[model samples]
Target: MSDFSGIWIPLITPFADGAVDHAALRALVRRYADAGVAGLVALGTTGEPATLDAAEQDAVLATILDAAQADANAADAADATDAQRRPLPVLVGVSGNHTASMLARIEQLNSLPIAGVLIAAPYYTRPAQAGIVAHFSALADASAHPVVLYDIPQRTGVRLELDTLLTLAAHPRIQAIKDCAGSLDTTLALIRDGRLQVLAGNDLEVFSTVCAGGSGAIAASAHWRPERFVALYRALTEGKLDEGRRIFHALVPQIQLAFAEPNPAPMKALLAATGWVRNELRLPMTRASAALTERLAALGETLPR
Candidate 1:
């Protein structure tokens, strides 16, 4: 498995003319590859995975793997006189309510070249912590790839309590977590517990998470200012607290606005302003406020995207 460390972009699925924009999607992958993110996440919450059909999801993952491979190959050719750069691994998000189907999904994904799977606790059902434990353990047991547990209680409506998390950590296949449970004590406890590699799923906490001895982040705000995010992670990992704080402080405003409205819309708006992708999204998911869109465009001028 690829190291679940450093910055990763939960890529937005770019849409255009009412269809998946493969050209723009590939461009986005190459953009992040050049920026040197640790990896790319596909079909994540930020990617609007809920709105895409199975076929669309499959295509998106394939495009990301292909682009990452091509980008790595090109970099090697360019620097053939030196050691080769490893292609960024792709992490695919898998979510479902039914355990059997979830396990089946993991089984299907085992055939792919992905590095791991990012899965949130079962949503809407509000299962007990024991049920949550069983759900994750069952998936982990069935999965051939590593599992990164996502604990965003707001969306899933039930916290994967710290005790439950500690228990799940014992599974060899459950290697890490996307820590969105919204508790500093929980975050710190998980870090100190020294079991699972805890990644900040909340964009605002990326720097704090890394500084607190957690792994890195699977950040949505990273869709913009990606290089700065990478720099911040590097700064923290190397114990340059002042440099890390400086980068985090500078990025706070963008992080706040990126999530001010619903996700990805504001993120996609900023990307569209930069001519990276169309500002379109699927039904039930709309674009950002025209007011915010203007601001994002202005903000885009300041970022290195």
Candidate 2:
């Protein structure tokens, strides 16, 4: 099983002139690596991978992996010692509604230097608990790399129940879970179960989840407040709850605003306002409104670095 135990950013997709901006994407990847994120999750919900076509998804994944590999090489050269260098893992999110399609994508991605797959529970259709387990079990068995189950029921109508998750955890390939179950009960259950490593998919619950014995988080808010999130994880791991809470409270406003609208849109707008990425989303996912843009901009300015 893959030990996915750290703070990973579900990176934002960059666009220029209604296309995947490769240059901007490479720059962003390098920037995040420099910022000290534990890893990079490409084509995640924050990356708007669903909006992109199949060819676009392949292009984005190849570009991200290449860039990350190049950055690791450079850092290794700088250190001049293997002990001082660690290659940052690249996790590709290939989640969708269909199990067969997802399995195919995982097979296609097998050649890449990707560390694992982040599979969200089947979205829409709201499958039964048994269906959810079957879906993930198939993917886990098919995937050559480790599988991290994503349970963001708020977006995906189907929720991977505790019992189903326990069953899935028995599969050696199914390593961890991105627990966005939005409840402390499920989070605690996973921790107490003693097998699946829980990652807080919700930014607000990261500290408490870690306190409850979670591994870490795969937060969208980390796109803007990467350092703060990293600090919270560090503090919690260091047994400094007071210090973690102080930073967590200060970041609540930004986190709330980032998710105010549909994903990436709010995060894209905030990044654009700060000159990170262009505030452009594909059809169906529009940019944040003027009022929200202003609010996010103001909040970005006050966020603790």
Among all candidates shown, the one with the greatest lDDT: 1
Q: How many residue pairs clash in each candidate at the backbone level?
A: 0, 0
Per-residue alpha-carbon lDDT of candidate 1 for residues 1-305, written as tens digits (9 for 90 to 100):
55898888999999989899999999988888877788889999999999998899899999989998887687646553211266778899999788998888899899988889999999999999999999999999988899999998899888899899999999999989999988999999999998888899998889889988999999999888788998999999999999989999999999988998998899999999989999999979999999999899999997666
So what's the TM-score on candidate 2? Answer: 0.94
- Top candidate (TM-score): 1
State the lDDT of candidate 2 residue by residue for 63-127, as single tens digits.
Answer: 88888877767754655333115566888898778888888888898777788999988888899
The candidate 1 region of ten consecutive residues with least summed lDDT is: 75-84
Off by over 4 Å in 2: 76-84, 303-305
